[model samples]
Target: MGAACIRERLDRALCSHPWIDRFPDTLVKHFTDQGSDHRGLLLSDKAYTRNSRPLFRFDARWADNPEVRAMVNYVWKEEIQGTPMFRLWERLKRLRHLLYDWSRAGTTNSLRNIKTLQAEIERIKLVHPVDWDEVRNLEFELNRQWEAEEIYKQLKSRVRWLKKGDQNSSYFHTVTRARRKRNFVAGLRSDNGDWVTEELGKADIATNFYQCLFTSETHVPNMAERVDNLPISQSITP
Candidate 1:
């Protein structure tokens, strides 16, 4: 019966933690309490799951598309009434969204249609290759789709040693799976000296370790000190 705009907005995802006030990972479901004026909050007892962030990389295939080039050129050259930095930032933001939209609209549908066309070609061939021209046309379409697929797979696998359009989608898939498996840590030791299997805990440990390792510390050796400490003898100096 009570009106709360923030409460209404956050009904699905409760930002406040169930136990501790921490970084947002909370979700809630509200239900009517029997004989009560206020709705009861049901806190999720399960561990919070982290959403996978999107990875955006440039696809070489898109470069060949005249339309894609025109789109990029148009967006890049759009005049914004602002200071140089502001204009650049706004343009970059727009470009990011544009590229994301473009990528989402890529070869998936074309490849799917190729499969359907392949089935149709097979059926027509069995019936007596009367649709020879149709088959040839579909083959051309398949070739185009394959090219896009190859470019996509190559970008994903980073295996540029092989020539393009070699029908290496399976190889690229295997490489990607293996890379993910190799990079994934099932568990990691936390600062508390316990094995933490939680994704958030492991991520925090890794982030902290790398940040500390890369950060400039209070006590550190400079390039001169590093040179002096080298194992090479003064007699063997170049």
Candidate 2:
């Protein structure tokens, strides 16, 4: 149970049902101000299913590393036995696999990696004069991870206003969740008075409505002559 007290006495509390655990539910729900001492619980059971969407993308930042470019050059120099297009596609596919593995190499538990790097830096500073080369490497790794995270957030949120390295991870997370909630269609009432609670049903109902509206048989009445008769701001000679 959690609560925010509006009264001076702190007498109010918010709680979940005793049987809430029996069902898969949490008490971390919002409430409305009903002008009462106690906050009324908002029991929300809205389930928003997000489909797995892994996009095939090449990180342009990988081009910044000379080692990566060298690898690409080597791959291109290799003569693969295939049609020109097929050979190119195969080589690119192989490069994509290599880059994906490289990208994932240090990205797992990035926070832990950041902390570890920070600790190492601190330890080095205390033990000896800071190794600037090691520090730079650590900073580079952190920046790369941050860029990777930003790319993920940008794709997931669909909001392009925010730029990378603005310390807006929290903002991106909030925006992404809000977008998911906004996109969720809990239910829709169909023309036949049937409630479409299923995902496919809701989609069909919305699709048909828009399709019908666009393909409407209603003719638009001509109002060009009526507009011409209306009083004009400029003096008309005719």
Candidate 3:
């Protein structure tokens, strides 16, 4: 038999029923062939736990609540005995924890709230009396939720051309998902010339690299002499 080069969609990923059941949210991605004739496939589970803690992001929607402003004012007014920079840093750290705690309890799932409010409004309309007041109240809440959802997606998408809360939630969502996929780091190459695919391994590699980079092993005994030795074309005399 002789080998022939031809373009065809012959490569595919196959999985057993048990495997699918175990990783229900698994996503398969295709990569272009580098040295081989066939494309490479990567499988990732969306629900897999991440090794590193997620970074905190401020949600602009939180500003809409009057209580959030009051909370910030209270945190800033707290007394802390320290140098100017140290006091500012401590206050910011405390404010971050305070806001995080408040946000966890104060924030509602906007999409879920929107759906629930919509359902309730529909139910209210179905009533024989059609309680107009109740429907109006529900509608108002639904609109607020919709705005929150829009602001969230807008922030994620980083798209500012279109004004947020203009009912372009779907567009923003699609852009956000695309950006996330583009920015995702599936794997990394370690300093030991090894591929690190697991999140923990990649994190370790990054941590070690940065630790070595920023940690100074040698101490300078004569810092003033070293600075004075540098050639200077011009000097300022006071």
Instruction: For each candidate in turn, give its C-alpha RMSD to the true structure in angstroms.
Output: 17.3, 14.2, 11.2
TM-score of each: 0.47, 0.41, 0.54
Sequence-dependent TM-score of model 2: 0.41
Query: How large an RMSD does model 1 have?
Result: 17.3
State the displacement of the C-alpha of residue 21, model 2, in Å, after optimal TM-score superposition. 19
Predicted candidate 2 versus true structure: per-residue lDDT over 110-203, tens digit per residue: 4566677778767767766668888788778777767766666676666777586775677666666555444545579999999767766776
Clashes of each: 0, 0, 0
Best by TM-score: 3
For model 1, residues 73-187, the per-residue Cα lDDT tens digits are 9888898876565566667668777878876874445567668878877887887537788878878877887777777777767788758557646767767655543454557
Top lDDT: which candidate number? 3
Please estimate how well model 3 matches the true structure, expressed as its whole-model Cα lDDT.
0.74
**Candidate 3 lDDT by residue in tens digits, 1-238:** 2477567765677766456546655767778877877888888787755766664567888886888788888878989875565567667668778777876773556878888888899888888989998888889888889888877777888987767558746666666655655566767898778978787787788767655544434354797897898777578679
Q: Each model's C-alpha lDDT? A: 0.66, 0.63, 0.74
Ranking by lDDT: 3, 1, 2
Error of 3 at 68 (Å): 1.1
What would you estimate as the lDDT of candidate 1? Answer: 0.66
Between candidates 1 and 3, the lDDT winner: 3
Regions of candidate 3 where Cα sits further than 4 Å from its true position: 1-49, 163-170, 181-238
